[model samples]
Target: MELRQLRYFVAIVDHGSLSRAARVLHIAQPALTQQVQQLEEELGAQLLHRSAQGVMSTDAGKTFYEHAQAILKQVEDARSAVAQSSDKPAGTVALGIPQSVSSALALPLLTAVREAYPEITLQLTEELSGTLIEQLKSGRINLAVLFDDGQLGAFASMPLVEEEMMFITRAGSQFAPKKKSIPLSRAVELPLILPGLQHGVRPRIENIVRAEGLSIGNVIDINSVAILKSALLADLGATILPVAPLLSEIEHGQMTAYPITGASISRTVTLCSSRNIPLTNAGHAVQRLVVSVASRLCVSGYWLGAKSLAKSESA
Candidate 1:
C-alpha cells in the first residue's frame, strides 16, 4: 500500500527471513512482519511461505518480486536523474554478453569504460543469449549482446555485426586447410560437435543446412563452449562457430578455421535493451562505447569474419 511496505516486502524476500530483514532495515521484527502482512492483504495474495531454514516466495510472490524490483530501480533512477550533476553521471550499469562475444569484447570494453566513465560502476555478465534475454526483461541487466533470430519484439535492438560461422578442426588433420573456405557438404561429412537446438546459433545453422538440402550425420551435442573447444582440440570432431573464441588457437596453429561456403551460415549480433525501460545517462554512455569499440575491432581486422553493421541498419 505504501513505498515503505514495498521496500519491506522486497527486503524480506531478499533476505529470505523476516527477522533477518528486520535487522537489515533496522526495524523490529514484528513491525516488518506487519508491513508484509499488510502488503499481502492489500494485494489479496499470500506472498511467502515460512520454513525452518528461512522462507521462500510462492509463485505469486515471485512474480510480484520481479515487479517490485523494477519499481524500486525506477525510483532510484529517477532520484539519480534529478540529483546527479550533468557533466558526470554516476551509477551502476550492468551489461550481459554471450561467451563467444565476451572472448572478444570483454577486456577491451572494460578498459574503455574505466577510462571514459570512471564514476560509473560496470557489471559484466557472461551468459547465453536466452538467459540474457530473461535477465533483460526482468531488469537485471541494462544492455546485452544477443543473437537476432527475429524474436526480440519486446526490446529495442541495434545491429552490431553479422558474423560468419567457421568450421573449425584440429590443425594438420585430414581436413587440412588449403583454401579460406569449405563447402557445406564437406563440412557435414565430417563428424560434427555442435550446440543443441536450444542454442541461438544452432537453429540458425540448422535453417541454413536445411535450406541447402543437406543432413548432418554423426553429430555430438555439446553445450559448454569450453568443452566444445576441448573436444575440437582433442580431435573429436569439427564444429561450426564464430571465430572470436578460436582466435588464440588459430594463431598458435592449434586449430584451423575455414568459412562454411555453400551454406554461409551466420548470426547477426544485436545490442538490445528492454523497450519499456528507458536508458539512463550511464546506459547511454555504455551503449555508445560498445558500438564504437565493435566498429573499431571490425575495421581494424581484430575480429575476423565480422562485418560492422551500418548505423542505418540498426533499429
Candidate 2:
C-alpha cells in the first residue's frame, strides 16, 4: 500500500475521528475518509466503523494498525538515514531498563550516547524485570539492560557486568557506621526494605538470610529500588541491593553499602537484544555506552568502604 494512505489510516486510528485527523494532517475530512476506505479495500477488510462516538478499529484494523505503525517507523528511519550525513545513526533507539538497572546505569549511558552518537535519539522506558521482558518480546524496545539473566530462552544476551550485591544501611544507623563495614550478624537488627520477591534479588536474599539462620524483626517489601534508597536514606530500613542500584547514593553518602561477607551473592546484569535480529548501529552504540558506564560506576562504588578507609588512613 502507499505510504501516504498508511499514514492517513494511522492518523485516523490515532485521532479516533476523521475530522480530527484531517485537521491534524492539514487535509480535508472527506479526502481523509476516502483514503482510509481505500486502505481497507486493499486489505479486504472493514478497518473502522463510526457511531455517535468517534471511529474505532475493527479486529482486522487493530491487527493492521500494529504492522502499519512499524512500517511507518521503518520508513521514517530510512528517510532519516538517507538524508543525514555519514557516520550517524539518525533513528530512534528505544531502550527498556528495569528501575533497578536505571538507578545503576542511566546517567552514564545517556551522557556517553550524547557524546558518541549525536544523531541517535534515545527513548527510555523503565519498568521492573517482568514487564520489561514482555516489552522486549513485543518490540516495544530495541535493546534492554536487565537484572534477570537466566531462563531467557530466546533473547540474545551478554554479560553487561556482574555487580556484587551489598547489604546497606544508613550512615547514622547503629548497623553501618563503625570502625569497619558491618558484619553479617548485625544485619538482622535494623529494619529492612528490599525489592519485591519477583526479582532475582529477593530469592538470593531469602537464601542468604536462611543460610545464616538469621531473622529480621522489621522488614519492608518494595517494588522500586529508588524507594529502597529513599527508605535507607531516611533510615527507615536497610537493604541488600545491587551495588549498581545504590552506586550514586552511596557515593554521595546518602546511603552506605557494606559487603555481604557472611555469604557472597551477586546478580549478573545482562545486555539483551532480539535474538532473531542483530542490533542496528544505533542500537549497538547505546548498548556499548550502557555496558561501559555501568561497569565504571559499579566498579568505583564496589570498593567504597575500602576506598574511604585507605583515604582516611593516609590522611
Candidate 3:
C-alpha cells in the first residue's frame, strides 16, 4: 500500500529471500516479514510461496511485481523531472526496440543518447514487437520502435520509416532468387522460414499474399533472430523480412536480399508512446533524438531499403 512496502517487496523478489532483502535494506528480518504479510493481507493474495531455502513469487505476485516495478519507475521519474534542469535533463528513460529494428537502430541510438544526454540513463530493451507493445502499454518502457499495424490508435505515434520486405536466403543456397527482385507469388512458393502470426511482419505478409490469391505452402516458424540467421545459413529455408535483421549477413555476402516485386511488401516503422502516460523531460529528449537518428540513417542509406516518412504522417 505504501511506497516503502513496494520497495521492500521488490527487494525481496530481487534477492529471492527475506533475510537477504532485510540485510540489504538494513531492517530487521521480523519487521520485513511483517511488512510483506501486511501487503499480502491488504491485497488478499498470497504473493510469495515460502520455502526453507528462500521464496518465490506466486502467479499473482508475478503480475503485481510488473506493476510494482512500473509504479516505482514512474515515482523515480517524477522526482527526477521536478529537480532536473531544462538544459540538462537527468532521469532514467526505458526504450523498447523490436529485435529487427534493434539490428540497425540500437547502437546508433545508444551512442547518440550518451553523447547528447550524458546525465540521462538510457535503458534499451530488445524484444519481439508483440512483447514491446505490451510493455509500452503497461508503462514499463517510455517509448518503443514498433511496426504500424493499423491498430495503434490507442498510442501516440510518429511514423519514422517504411521498410521494404525482402526475400532472403544464403548466398549459395538453391532457394536464392536469381534476379534482382522476385515476384511475391514466386517468393512465397519457396521453402520459407518465417515468424508466426503473432509477429508484426508475418500478418502483413499473409494479408498481402491472400489478397493476391496466393498462399504460403511450405514454411518453418522461427522467432529468434539469431536462430533464424543460422537456419538461413544452414539452408533450412528462405525468409521474407526487412533487410535490417540480416543486414550484416547481406553486406558480408553471406546472405542475399531480393526485393519482393509483384506487391508493395513493406511495414511502417513508428515511434510510439502510451497516450495515457506523460513522458518525462528525458523521455521527450530521447524521443526527438530517435526521430532525428532514423532520418539521418535513412538519408545516409545506413538503414537499407528504408524510406523516411514525413512528419505530417504522424498519428
Candidate 4:
C-alpha cells in the first residue's frame, strides 16, 4: 500500500530471499517480512511463494511486479525531473535499440551522450524490436529506436530514418545473387535464414510477400544477429535484413548485400517513448541526441541505405 512496501516487495522479489533483501535494505528480516505480509493483505492475494531456499513470485506477484517496477520508475523520474537543472541534467536514462540498428547508432549515441551530458548515465539495451516494445511499455526502458510496424499508436514517436532491406549472403557462396539486386520472388526461393514472425523485419517481409501471392519456400528461423551473421558467413543460408548490421563484412568483401528489387522492402525507424509516460529531463536529452546521431550518420553516408527523416542538430 505504501511506497516503502512496494520497495520492500520489489527487493524481496529481486533477491529471492527475505534475509538477503533485508540485509541489502539494512532493515530487520522480520520488518521486511511484515511489510510484505501487509502488502499481500491489502492486495488480497498472496504475492510470493516462500521456500526454504528462497522466495519466488506467484502469477499474481509476477503481474504486480511489473506494475510496481513501472510505478517506481515513474516516481523516480518525477523526482529527477523536478530536481534536474536545465543546463546540466543528471539522471539515469535507459534506451533500447534493436540489434540491427545498434550496429550503426549505438556507439555514436553513447559517445554523444557522454560528451554532452557527462553527469547523465546512459544505459543501452540491445534487443529485438518486439522485446524493445515490451520493455518500453513496461517502463523498463525510457526510450527505444524501433521500426514502425503500423502498431505504434501507443507511443509518441519521432521519425528517424527509413532503412532499406537487402538480401545478404556470403560473398563467394553458390547462392549469392550475380546482379546488384534481386526480385523478391527470386530472393525468397533461396534458402533464407530469418527471424521468427514476432520480429519486426520478418513480419514486414511476410506481409509484402503475401500481398504478391508469394510464399517463402526454404527458411531457417534465427533471432540473434550474431548467429545469423555466422550462418551467412558459413553459407548456411542468405538473410534479408538492413545493411547496417553486416556493413563491415560487406565492405570487407566477406559478404554481399543485394538490394531487394521488385518491392519496397524497407522499414521506418522511429524514436519512441510511451505516450502515457512523461520523460525525465535526462530521457528527453537522450532522445534528442539519438535523433541527432541518426541524422548525422545518414547525412555523412555512414548509415548505408538510410534516408534521414529528422534534421541534424547538436546534441
Query: Which pairs of residues collide in candidate 3?
Result: none
Query: What global local distance difference test value does model 1 have?
Result: 0.85
Tens-digit lDDT string for candidate 2 (73-100): 6666556556655456656888888786
Candidate 4 lDDT over 287-312, as tens digits, reads 88898989999999999999999987
Clashes of 1: 0
lDDT of 3 by residue, 1-315 (tens): 999999999999999999999999999999999999999999999999999999999999999999999898889878888888877888999999988889899999899889988988999998888998989998989999888889999899999999999999999889977778889989888899998788888888998899999999999999999999999999989999999999999999999988788788999999999899889889888998899888888988999999999442110
Give the alpha-carbon lDDT of every model: 0.85, 0.71, 0.91, 0.91
Local lDDT at 55 for model 3? 94
Q: Which one wins by TM-score: 1 or 3?
A: 3
Better of 1 and 4 by lDDT: 4
**Over all chains combined, what TM-score does candidate 1 have?**
0.84
User: In model 2, which runs have C-alpha deviations exceeding 4 angstroms?
Assistant: 1-22, 27-88, 174-179, 182-190, 207-218, 295-315
- Give candidate 2's root-mean-square deviation (CA, Å): 6.9
What's the CA error at residue 250 for candidate 2, in Å?
3.3
Per-residue lDDT of 295 in model 2: 56
